[model samples]
Every structure is written in structure tokens, then in C-alpha cells.
Target: MALTFTEEQEELRTTLRRFLADKAPSAAVRRAMDSDEGHDPLLWRQMADQLGLHGLALPEEYGGFGGGPVELGIVLEETGRVLLPSPYFATVALAGQALAASNDEAVKARWLPAIADGSTTATLALAEASGSWRLEDIETSVGNGTVSGTKMFVVDGHTADLILVVARTDTGTGLFAVDGDAPGVTRTRLETLDPTRRLARVDLDGAPARRVGPDGDASPYLRTVLDLVAVALAAEQVGGAQACLDAAVAYAKVRVQFGRPIGSFQAIKHKCADLLVQIEGARSAAYHATAVAAEGSSELPVSAALAAACCADAFTHAAKENIQIHGGIGYTWEHDAHLYLKRAKSSEQLFGGPATHRARLADLVGI
Candidate 1:
């Protein structure tokens, strides 16, 4: 089957690209990454208020545009194109999905509007001190509507208005939403290699929380949320990969070597060709996963896993090769090649990494 973009999708993509080009050019991205907040709040507001992006995937009742996973995938892909330094992915892609999957209407009513309007930023506090993303490995305890434990590498943890924490209860793993400034909640930002994406180590010392769903049957819901995240992230990976490929190709045509353009060299030509092939393949995988997510079919899980793993590898490989094609300039901090590389690495590890997804895909197929 072939993947085709709807008119709305094409329009959305064009608007976002123009917005980024005007508001967040490469210099602005570099400045944001170099800033303490690691992002620009003004640009975020433009994306939320001006574009209504925060609400794109939310229901209409929640002040959203009533779009679904496919819309979100489109937004993520555009965000990847410019490497927009914001927490939209962590907030919308993961936390929004977590809330949507919750069984509690009260929680949804309270949080979804804020999220949809960009009045609130939320993140999933799932990865523990052991840094394991599995439900079984979540050792944080939830008791008496209170939670206690340390959640590491929480995306936007420090900046979130709310935190959806996955903690272990007596019954099993459960989802809880704790206030960002709730008492007993402490945070420490890690000095990470990727400055564009912020992560924090969150410590919950019996922090008061509102339980969103039951504890025992969280595995299935968790899988669904993860699949949705993967679908959107795969689109982002493909976008990043395509950006890298274009950069490499453009540089090869312009950069001179041996008294001739690098594009004339057989080695650089082969490298660009390989990168283009990988990007096309990754685009196919990402489109398939997005379709499966939108359809909510039984094949969603396997397709999402396959797409996530393949996109991660493809994007990472293409990004590294792009830098290599740029030679010494790509390695410098002054160049934009490293930015794509950092994003590729961070995104690859976001949803349990390639190995994790491949293993999950294998198990999902009962192989």
C-alpha cells in the first residue's frame, strides 16, 4: 500500500515549516539550546496559541482540534525538521497519551484542558533509578494516594506543570498525576549531552498524587501508550534523517575536494545514495506505523515497534554519515550537523531504544 498525505496534512506541514523558518531559524535553535531554559517560551506559545498545536491530538471538548495520532505525527515531523527545542514531544506525545488512556474521567476533565491549551506541561515519570522502562521494573510505590521513589531521565520533569508517574502499587503498576510543585517532589537536572532536550531526575518522597487508573492491568495500557509514542517518534526520526540526507547531498555538491566538487567523487555519491535509501525506507516504516496507530488495529503494536526500531537505526546511521560527509566542519560545535546527531541519538533511546523495541516486536509476534 502507498502512503499519501491528506490536504489538511500538507497544509499543516507547510504552515509549520513557514512558522519555523520565520520564528525559529537555525540561529534561534542554537540560541535556545545554549540558553538555561533550553527553549524559548515565546516560540512555544506561538506553536500552542497561534497554531493550536498542543490541542491538535486532543478531543474537541477538551479545547482541542480533535485530531488524532496521525496529526500528532505530522507535527512531530515538522518539529524534527528544524529541531525545535521544546517539550512538546514529551508533553503531548507521551503525557497526553497517558492521560487519554487513563480510566478516570475526573483526571481527564482536570488535566486535559490545561494540556490542550498549553497552560500545563506534563511528563511521564516512568523510568526509575535503574533506568528501566518496563512495568515490572518500576519499583516506585503508590499507597494511600501517595507516591515515593526516584524517577530518572524524566523528559521535561523540571519544567512540567504536572507529572504522570508510573509507580508500583501492591496490586501492580499504576498511573498517578502529581503536581509539579507538590510537596516532597524534588528535581535535579542532569548535565546531558543533548542540551536541546531537557531531562531531570525526579524524587518523590511520599508525594501526594491523584490516581488515574487501576494498578494491576497497566501493562496493556502502557503498551498502547508506547505504541502511539513510537508512531509519532518514528515520523520525527524520518524527518531528522531526511534533513541529514539533504544536508549531506547539498554539502557534497558545494564542498570542493581534489580540485573538484565532492559530489563528483564516487565515494561521496555512494554515501549520499545510501543515506537517501535509508531515509526512504524509514519513511515507509514510519508511515506504516502511523497508519496502524490511527486505525487502532491488532497489528498496531508490532508495526509500531518495527517502525521505532527501524527509524532509530536509519536516522542514526544517516546522521552519522551526513556528518562524515561534511568532514571536519561537522564535528565542530558551530555546525548544525551535531545538532541532528544529538537529536537522533536522544530520539533513538526515547522509547526503550532499538534493541528494546526489536525484542518487544519479537514477543508481540510470538516468535
Candidate 2:
């Protein structure tokens, strides 16, 4: 609640920041985004092997450190700052969280260890052609141990080793595990504004599948998983917003206009000051949600919605103002400013956008 980090947390942030600076610099990020795999496999392995990042938030019984949302948020925020162009978010934040939150021990035992060790990549396929993130809007259905439907905007869907498909069943909404390469599964990479993060369309035509969670209504469990993920995404947005503010201030200090540094101008100073205030507010919102998630508090839903709305808006604003501060140079293909803006805009819409989150927040708070 105080938004203060422990000493260890600060160390973790420092280590990850240094690592990203060395391994995931601008050129490296560009290379990975342009490559077919969309990320460096070697770096991915190193993250698991050296840093144990993939397992930081997983249960120790599943070959992890048994950390929670707070630890995962730290990792995500660091990765987001660099726009690392990796499937870490899809593999760990999305699928890993879903499996961990499920009611099936067998499912967790079968999949979580692989995820912790970074041996497998996976993603949750929730949104579809209808362009909705709500469980009630899901049209994918399961029958006779098979799933059939088209899932769009699946993060890392084309390359993930496993696909956790949210499908409709006679009982209620359920989670189905379908092997990425299984028969009757078709995956197509989609062209997106944010090339740093890849998305895909997955078509399942009677794909063999096994139910991962309860046979009865699993909507409640799925909703909790979604809330946790929203908090994690908010952490990432905070990092991106902070980066934009830093970049803008740094550029304003150096770039000259009217025989003086632009940062010395009152308008530029006001913009920087406003961005700092917004970023700090967003950071507090994200940190509070992370704490609530770690505590498994009943307030997670409200906190998550609040974080999602605040952080998304803050990140987008920071990115836009960052571009504005840099003037014409920021608009160029060679500049990294545009990439940050693209990531901000793309992530803002990833889980229903700021307006959707605000509406959810209002409904949850009975306002």
C-alpha cells in the first residue's frame, strides 16, 4: 500500500535492468522483432538458467521459487521497459498463471514445470473474432473431447508449444489444452502495429483437446486468473510510462531551441512535471494491485480494474508526450520513440482498453 519496494526487490530490479541493457539493447530488440521467431532463443534460455526469471513466481513444487504476483510484476516491468520482444509475457504471465490457478493438479503437474524451466512456450487464447475479452462472449465450444473455433489476437499463438483455449461447454466456460502442432490446428501470424509483441489467429477444427480445469462452471476461477493478469499488465505499463518520461526529460535537457535547452522552457518543464506526476500515480496503482494479488485479497477485482485503467491511460499519455517533446525526430523510423508509442497503444487495447476497465471499475465499486 505504501508503494515501497524491499531491498531484495530493488536488487532484482537493478540486476534485470543491467541485464536488459547489455542483452536486449535497441539493435537486439529490433533484430528479434524482425526475425521469424520474434525473440532470441538463447537469451530466453539464459534468463531461465542464469536468472531463474521464468520460475520466479511459480510454485517451488513445480521447480520454481514459489514467489507470487509481486515477483512476477518486477520481472514484467523490467522486460516491458526494454520492449524485449519475447514470449515471456505469453508463456509466464498468461498461460502459466492460468494453469497455476486451475483446479486440476494433473494439469499443473504436467505443464508448470516445463514452463518454469522455459522448455515450453504457451499462451491463453481468449479473445476471438467477436473482439471481446469477456467470458460470456466466448463462442469457442468443446464437444466429444475436441475443440472447434477460431481464436484471434492470441499472443505468441503461432509459436507457442501449447494453447490454452477458453471454450464453451454444456456445463459452463472451461479451459482446454490443445497442443500447438496437433492435427486440425491452424495458426497464422498477424501483422500488428507493435511488432515487438507478436499476435496470431488460431483456428481449431475439431482439434483433440483435454479439459484442464473443473468440468463444471470454471468462470469464477478464470475470472481470478484474468484479474491477476491485469495486475501484471499494469506493472508493465508502469515501466513503459516511466521509460517514456525519462526519455522525454533527457531529450528536453539536451535539445536546443531558441538559443536555450528546450527543458528550460516553461511549457517543456510543465509537460515533464505533469508526466512525472501521472507516471507516479500509475506506479502506485500498479503496486497496490500487485500487493492485493499477492495477498489474494477480495479487493483484487477492484484494484485490478483501477490499475488497468490508470496505467493504460498513463502509459499512452507518457508515450505521446515523449514524442511531442522530441518534436520531428521522434517521428522517424530510426528513432525508438515510435516503437514505445506503438507498444503503449497496443497494450492499452490488449485487455479491453482504458474505457472498458473504467467501466468495469465503476460497476465493481457500485458507483
Candidate 3:
């Protein structure tokens, strides 16, 4: 597939890129990351209430734009480009996708409206303390109207208004919705490596559990949610890699070495050339996956896995090369290169490492 964006999509990307450049510059992102709430409420409100980005990909019944994954992919890419320190990915890409996969209309009617309007934020808690992404690795149990055990690394778990808990049921894993402030539920913020992305530990002591899908065999729904999330994340990685490459090239043009621009050197040229190749390849794969997702194709799993591994490695490579290209200044805290590097490293481990996804792809394509 060509994986080209429509004119409307290009316009959307331009608008969001301009908006984030103005509202979420490196200084703003740093401030938000260090703030008490760990994000800018006002900025988030503007992105949601003003731009209507919170509902961009949701159904019209839930007060959204009724768009598909392509729109969501655009927003996520812009957010990644600027390192916007909001719960956007966790809320929209993860939780929103999960809720949309549920078979229960009553549950959707209750939750989707609030989420669509930006009146509420939510996250899906799937990874347990073991930190495995596999569905079978989940150990937190839910049965007889109760949930037990704990989940870790829940994005925005501390501040979200709603929580979607994936629990071990009698038949298999089940998706449950729990009110954030419900009794016997605890959320503690973790001191994560990347402060821009919030991580929380959620402990549920017989907390209320309501199955969002059918009572038995919810793995298909979970897989669907994960595939959607992977496509979004891959796009984000491409954006970040693009930013890193831009920064490196810009620096190479200005920084003089031996009375000439460093970019003229064969070594620097080779590094930049290598980065460009990786980023372009990753971008192609990511955009293809996003396009496939918009079509709701059955090939999503293989595409998602390919995009995930390709984008993850590309972003990490670009970040590291960006720092190396900058020489000394990139090593300091004052520079923004490290921020992209940190986020790139964190994102690599978010769903699972690149190696993990490649392994999954091996089975997904029967290689």
C-alpha cells in the first residue's frame, strides 16, 4: 500500500503540530512533567475541549468525530513529536480502544460518553507485577462479583476517573470496569524512568468488578484492543524518530569542525544516512499498519507486530544517534535530546520490548 495521508489528514497533522509547538514546547513539557499533577490540566482541556481530540476517533453515539484509527494515529504522532506529557495514549489509544471492543452496550453507554467528552479519563490495567504482556500471564482474579490482587504500570491510574481491569476469571481473562475511587482500591504513583509518562500501581482488595464483555473467553477482545494500540504506538515512534533525525541534521549543519560544518564529514554523513534509512523504513511500516487498521483488516496482527518492532528499534536508534551527533551538549540535562531518548527507551518497553514483538511476529506469520 502507498500509505499516503489524505489532504484532510495532512491538515489535521499541521494543525496539531502547530498547536503542540505553541502549547507543549520542551519547556512546557518539562514543567508539566515536574508539576504536582504531572501534566498541564489547562493544555489537556484545550486539546480535548477545544480541539475535540479526545473524541476524534470515537463513535458518534458517544459524542465523537466518528473517525477511525487513522485520525487517532495522527494525534498520537503529533503528541510523540512534541513529547506532550498527557495521558492521551493511555486514555484514548488504550482504554478507549478496550471499551470499544466490549460487547456490553449498557457498560458502553455509561462509560463511553464521559470519555468521549473529556469529562473523564481512563486506563486499562493488564500487566501484573510480573510485568508480562501475555494474556495468560495475567494473574489478578475476578469472580463472584469481586476482584483481587494487584496490577502495575497502569498509565494514568492515579488520576483517571475510571479503571478497566483485566482479571483472571473461571473460563479465562475478563475485562472489568472499576470506579477509580471505589472502596478497597489503591493507586500509588511509581518513580518511573520517564517522568513524562505516568505509571501507577493499583491494588484491589475485593474491589467491585463488572465484566465488560461476555463472561467467558475475552482474549479476542483484548487482542483486538492491543492490536489497535500497537498501530497507534508505532506511529508515535515514527514521529519521535523523525524529531530526533531533524534535530541531529540541524545540529550537523551548524556545528563547525576543522573550519567546516560537521555534516560534511563522511562519518557524520554515514550516521545521518543510516538514520534516514531506518526512519523511512519504520515510517512506511507504521503508516501501512495505521492504514490497515482504518480498513479494519484481518491482517492487523502481523502488520501491528511488524510495525511495533520496526518503529521501536528505529526510534531508539535515532535518539542515540541524535545524542552522538550533538557531541557534548546532548549529554547535559539542559538539552532536549535526552528527553526523546528517555521516551524512546520507555516506549520500547511499554507494550513489550522490540525483541518480544518480533518473537510474537514469528508465530503470527508462522515464520
Candidate 4:
């Protein structure tokens, strides 16, 4: 499908880009990353109150704009470009999407308004100690109205007000809602490569749990949710890739070597040109996936897999090439280049690596 944006979508991108450039500058990002909360709460409120970002893609009855994946993708792309340190992704992309996709109206009524108004932070806990994202691999068990298991690599798990936990039941895999501070729940922040994003390990020892979706096997619904999340993440990856490309090109134009701008050099020019192509390709893939998701197409599985692989590889490549173009400065801890590289490397493995997505794509297409 052709990747096109409406005028309103374009305006959203422009507005969000300007807002982030003002509110989430490099210094603000560093401050948030180093803070215990891992993000600026006041800034978070501003995003909801001023931009209605928290409700951009939520249902209208739940205090949102009744938008869809495409709208959410636009917000994510802008945030990724600035490397904004916030729980927005965990709250909206991971947990919000899951809740919105759930069949239980009670669950949505009880939780979504809090999320929409920015009063609650939430995350979806799927990966276990095995570090697997597959639903069938889940070993966490739920019995007698409680869930017991340890979840690893949970985004913002330590601090979220709500945690949507994936657990195995007698029938099949299911999603459970466990309060972050509920009795028997333990959340620990884990040391990670990307300071801009926080990850946690959650131990739910017979925690009182409320089933969020269907009563029986929810694997199919959960799978769709995962696909949606992958597409959302791809949007973010494209934004990050574009940022790296822009930074590299800008630096090349100003930093002179051999009595001329490095951008005039064939080697630097080639690297920048290549990065631009890769980023644009990734952008298209992400945009296409978002469009597929918004339309609820049957082609979603194929499109999501394609996007997951393409965008991850492109972002990682762009980040590395950006550093190389900047020479020694990019390698320094003081420079922002390393930050982008860290985010790229970490995000590449978040849902699964590029290779994993490609393997899934092959299976999906019966290749």
C-alpha cells in the first residue's frame, strides 16, 4: 500500500515534533533518564493536558479521541526522534493497546479512563526468564484467581500503576491484571543498556489477578495485540533512524576536514546517502504496517513481520553509520550519538531481533 498521511496527520507530526524539540531536549532527556522515576511526570501531564497524546488513540467513551493505530504511530515516531524519556510507550503502546483490544467491557471501563487522563501508568509483561515473546512459551501460571510467575524485560514495570501479565491457565494463555503495588507483587528495576528506557523484572507470587479479556483461550487475541505492538514499535524505530540520518548529515555539512566540509567527501556522502535510503525504506514499511493495522486487514501478520524486521535493521544500521560519520566525537559518552546507538541496539531485541522477525515472516508466508 502507498504510505500517505492526511493533512491532520501531518499537522500532528509537526506539532509533536515542535513540542518535543522544546520540552524533551537533550538536557531534559538526560535528566529524566538519570532520575529515579525515569521520566518527568510534569512533562507527562503536559502531553496529556496540552496535546491529548495519552488519549490520541483510545476509545472516545474512555476519554480519548477515538483514534486508531495510525494516530498513535504518529505520536510514537515523534517521541522516538527526540529519545523522550517517558512511560508513554509502556502505558500507551504496550498496555493500552492490549486493554483496548480486550473483549471485556468491564476491564476497559475500569482502567482505560485512568490511562487516558494520564493518571495511571501501565505495562504489559510477556517475556519471561527464557526471554521469549512467544505466548506458547509462557510458564507463568494462573490458578484459583491468582497468578504466579516472574516476568523479565517488562517496560516500566517497576513503577506502573497497572501491570497486564500474561500467564498460562488450564485452558490456554491468558492476560491478567495485577496491580503494581498489590500484595504478592514485587517489581525490581533492572540494569539495561538504554538509560532512555527503563526495564523491570516483576515477580507475581500468587498475586490476586483479574482476567482482562476472554475467559477461555486468549492466544488469538493476544497474538493480534502483539502484532499491533510490533507495528507501533516499528514507527518509533523509523523516527529514531530518521533522527540519526539527520544528525549525521547536519554534522557532515559543518565539520570541515582537509579544508572542506566532510559532506563534500565521497565516503561521507555515500554513508549519509545510504542511511537516507534505509531510513526512508523503514519509514515506508512502518507506515504501511500502521495502515494495515488501522484497517484491521487480514494481511496484518505479514505486514507486521515485514515491518518488525525492516525497521529494526534500518534503525540499527542508521545509528552505527551515524557514529562512524561523526568520527571520534560520536564514540564519546558526552555525545548524544551513543544514546541513539544504545536505543537502537536495545529496541532491536525488544520484541525479538530482525532475524527472528524474518523467520516468522517466512513461516507466515509459507515460504
Candidate 5:
């Protein structure tokens, strides 16, 4: 298969990169993170209404642009580079995918258009306080058109207009869509290392809910969404790693040490070289996974697992080394290196860690 992007994809990437550069600059990101909603409402609208990024991966019939995973990857990669602090991942990635996977026309009509237009924010209350993304670890329950349980570290849970909760039913595991402001739903914001992406602990006590799919059917679909999530995160990680590498390299070239540029030193040169190599490998995995996700093949899971594992290692390594390369300044909060480090660690654990993905890969390929 051709590894390079097509002309249309390249144009798409250029558009997103420019948009993010202008709208999601570092200052903008910091401002959004500090805001009560933890994101910029205006920028969100621009992305949806102007760029149509919110609907890139959504179906055309549902008021989306009729694109797929690759287009989403383009936006995600750009967002990662700038560390854009928004609910895009929670809303566009998780909630959007769940809604797309559902067969409920009423549900799609109710939420997809709003999501596509950026008028509504959405998230998934799937994981528990134990912070497990595994199917077996889910303990939420739904009965008589209501839900009850605790979901913790839910991405943008506090501000979501719609929430897709994974609940255990009498038949099997299922997905339930709940109104974010519905009665019996209480959200508590949690202070986190990655404040740019807000996390919340949600308590749902007989909250109004609607089933999205048949019992047990959610497992495969959830797995597919998780794979997509992994792909999106991998794209983000690769972007972050690339940014760190660039920052470190630029700093080393100008920073004086022993009457010369530190980049001229063998130690620093070797470190930067190693980081570039790792980033190159990670980018390959990330891009390949995105393509595979768009194609919707049987090997999608395998591709996603590989990409996630590679990205986790790459982003973590690059973030740490970036700090080292920045010397004492990197340790300070004033420097942007620490922010990348925090994001790297947070993304690494969001879905499954590297070990978890590796295990899943073994199972998927029967290795």
C-alpha cells in the first residue's frame, strides 16, 4: 500500500495545520485550559462551523462532512502539536464514534447534528473510579430507562451536553445515552496533571437513559471505537513527540555550552538523533493506523495496538529527553516542556497502557 498521503490528504493536513496554528496557539491553549469550561467556545465553533472538522469523521446524512478516520487524524495531529486544550477528543472522538456506531435513528437525529455543528458537547462516561478502560471493569448499570453508577476521570464529563455511558444490563454490556443535565446526574471536576483536558467523576442515580444498541453488541462496537481512540491518541502522541524533538533541537543549536553550541557536542547530538529515529518510527505507525482505521479492515485492531504501543514509548521518551535537553529550565513550570510531559503521560494511560495494548495485539494476532 502507498504510505504517502494523497494530494487531497496533504491539502487537508495543510488546512488543519494552518487553522490550529492561528486559532490554537500556546496562549490560546493556556487560556482555554484555565477557563471554567476548559476550552474555547469560539474556537470550537470555528472548527465546526468554519472548518467542518467536527463533522469530518461523521456520516453525511447525520450533518457531517462524510469523511472518515484519516481526516480526523489530520485535525488530531495538528491539535496535538499545539497542545490545544479542548473537548475535541472527548466530544469528537469518543462521543462522535459511539453515536456513529449506533443504529438508533432518533438518537442520531437528536445529537449528531448538534455535535456536528459544535452547538453541543459530548463525552463518554465509560470508565470507573478504578480508572479501568476494560470491559470487565465496567460496573455501571441501567434499568427501566435509567442509569446508576459512578464513572470517574470521564473526559469533559462535567461539560458534556450528551454522555454515552457503558452499563451492565441483565443480558450483557450495553451503551446508554444520557442527557448531561438530566436529574440524578452529578459531576465533580477533578484536578489533574493534564488540566487542558478536564476530567470528572460522575455519579448517576437513576438518570434518564436511552439504549444505543442491543445487549452485548456494544462490546465489538466499543472495541472498534477504542481502536479509533487509540489511533487518534497515537496521532496526538506522534505530533507531541515531533514538537518536543523540534524544541529540543532548536534549543540545543542556540544554547551555548563550553564556548559553543550544545548541539555541536557529541552527547547532545546523539540524544537528538535517537529522538528523531524514535519519532520517525512512531509517525509511521500512527499514520498507518489512521489509514487502516479509515479502511475499516480486519487488521484495524492490530494496526491500532501497534500504533498505540509505539506512540506511548515515543512520546514518553521524547518528553523526558526534551526536559533534559532544556536543562534546569525544563523542570520549571514556566517552560512548555513540562506541559508536553504531562500530556504524554496522560495520553499513555487514557485508553490502555503500552503493556495492555501489547497484550491485546498478541490476542488479536493469535501470537
Candidate 6:
């Protein structure tokens, strides 16, 4: 599988980046983040209908563009740079994958078409209060056509039309689909470090749920979707890191100090250089993971884990360094630096944190 983007891929990035810059500017992000819905449905439609981004990776039979994971990675990177406040990631990376990978064709038929058409949105409700990525941490039970318990860290949970819940069943862990507004389903918006991505606490007390997969171990598909999500997030983190680095360099070049640009100083140059090197490394890891995912390579687990851990740290570091380089103004809420920092912090924990992925990596590599 090729690690580099093709000409068509580059064109996709250019198009997406331009679109996001015009429509999803920082002001738009601020407005969306402050709104009750945490995202603009209109913008979501524009992205899906106009850009055809929502179906980039699904099969053409499902109304998709029949692209692959690399295309999705490009879309994610561009969206991350602008902090797009949409449920595209949750819908595509989480629920879409769960349905696509599950054993039940009925569930796929019921969901994939609408998802591919961007008519409905969905997310995977996996991690619980334990804050663990392990399937065992899922306390929700799926038995007798009901789901019981709570799921925390559900991305875009409040707005998802459908929720693919991971729950324990009589046979083993299984996947279940529950309507967002179904009876006994409660979603409480949680105040998060990053309001750009709305998170909610989902409570299911005997909520009506239909089985979406076989009544057996769903670990393989679960892991597959989670890995893809990790790869997508890693791409986003790399984008944020690159943005922070660019912002720091631009500021350092213009902000005069001692009658010259502050960037002339050895200290400032060293900081920027360090960030550039790390950001590039993180980019390589994320890109390689994306390419691997696109090809369905056997090395996906290790690549995804590495991308998750490396990109998380690199993005966080780049954001912190950007703030440090910017001095006092970066700390203010008005500045965009803090927004990227908050996103970095929030993303580090989604799906699994760097440390969690590090452990997973060790096991996968047999180290």
C-alpha cells in the first residue's frame, strides 16, 4: 500500500481545505461550540451533500463514493485543522464501521444506506464509566431485547439518530442498535474540555434495542472499528499539531522583539524546529496507519496503536509549545491557541489514551 497521497488525493485535500476555510472558519466554530446542538445540521448537510464526504469510504451500493480509508483520513485531517463541529467522525468512523463490519446484513441494510446518503447520523456507544477501552468494561447488558446500564464518553451521542451500543449478552459481548429517542434512553450533555465535540452520558434502563450482530463474541469487529477510529483520530491530531506549528512560526516571524522578529532568536528557532520534527514524525505515523487501513493490511493494529500514541503526544506537545511561543496572549480565551489545546486534551482520551494504546502496542508487538 502506498503511504503517499496520489494526485487525486491531493486535489481532495485542497478542495476540502478550501471548503472548510470558507464555511468552517474559527468564528463559525465558536458559534457552533456555543450552541445547544454543538453543531450545525446545515453545515453537516453541505459537507455530505455538497462534498460527498460522509460516504467517502462506504461501498457504492450503499450510496457512497466507494473511496477508502485514505480518503476518509484526508477529510478528517482537513476537518481537524478547522475544528469542524460536526458528527461526521462519529457517524462514519464509529457507527458506520460497526454496521459495515457486523455479521447481520439486515442491520447493514437498515443503516448503511441512510448513513451513506448522510440522511441519518450515528455513533458507537462503547466506553463506559470505567473509562476503559476493553470490552469487559462495558457494563451494559443486552438480553431479552433490552439494553440496561450507562455508557459514557459517547461522542455526538445527543445528536445521533442511531446508537450502536456495545453490551454483554447471554452468549458474549454483542452489538445492539437503539433509537436515540427511544423510551428509557436518556442522554445528558456533559460539559467537556472541548465543546467542539459534544459528549453525553447515555443511560439505558431496559431500553428497547435490536441485535445488530451475531449473538456471540463481537471482539474482532469491535476492535476493527476501534482501530479505524484511532487511525482517524491520529490523522486529526496530526492536523492540529501542524496547525499549531504553523501558527507559532507565523507569529514568531511577525512579532517583533528587540527591533527584529522574535523568530530570529536561537531559543525560538530551536522550539519551532523541535516541534516541526515531532509533527513530521507524527504525520508519518498517522499517514502510514491510514494507508495500512485502506489496504486492509495485517499490520493495522500496530500501526494504529503507534499512530494513536504518537499523534496524541505530538499534538499535545505542539499545542503547548505554540502557547509557550505566543506568550501571554495564547492563554486568553479569545485566542485560537487554547481551542486547539483543549481539543488536543480531549482527543487524547477518546477511544483510548496514549498510555492505553501504548500498552496495547506492547501486547501486539509481543514486547
TM per candidate: 0.97, 0.99, 0.98, 0.99, 0.97, 0.98
Q: Write the per-residue lDDT of candidate 5 for residues 1-367, one digit (tens) a residue.
A: 4567889889988988888888887888888989987889888888888889888889999899888878788778888888898889889988997788777788889889989988889998777878889888888888898999965568889889988998888877888988889999999999998867789999999999988855554788777878888898899888899899999999999999889999999999999999999999999998999888888888899999999999999999999999999999999977889989999999999987999999989998999
Query: Cα lDDT for residue 128, model 4?
Result: 91
Model 6 per-residue lDDT tens digits across residues 196-218 = 88898899998999988766787
Model 4 per-residue lDDT at 308: 95
Model 4 is weakest, by summed lDDT over 10 consecutive residues, at 149-158
lDDT of 2: 0.93
Predict model 3's lDDT versus the native.
0.89
Tens-place lDDT per residue, model 3, 11-88, is 999999999999999999999999988899999889988789988988888888898788999999889998888988
Rank the models by lDDT, top first. Answer: 4, 2, 3, 6, 5, 1
Q: Any runs in candidate 5 off by more than 4 Å, and if so which?
A: 215-217
Score each candidate by Cα lDDT: 0.86, 0.93, 0.89, 0.93, 0.88, 0.89
lDDT of 1 at 314: 93
After superposing candidate 4, which stretches have Cα over 4 Å from the reference? none
1 versus 6: better lDDT goes to: 6
Which residue ranges in model 6 land beyond 4 Å of their true spot? none
**How many residue pairs clash in model 5?**
0
Better of 2 and 3 by TM-score: 2
- Cα RMSD of predicted structure 2: 0.9
Give per-residue lDDT, candidate 5, residue 352.
79
- As for candidate 2, its clashing pairs are none
Q: Estimate, for each residue in 322-361, the C-alpha lDDT of model 4 and write its tens digit.
A: 9999999999998999999999999999988999999999
Model 2 TM-score relative to the real fold: 0.99
2 or 6, greater by TM-score: 2
**Per-residue accuracy of model 1 over 43-132 as CA lDDT, tens digit each:** 888888999999999888878888888888888888888888898988899999888767667888898899888888999888877767
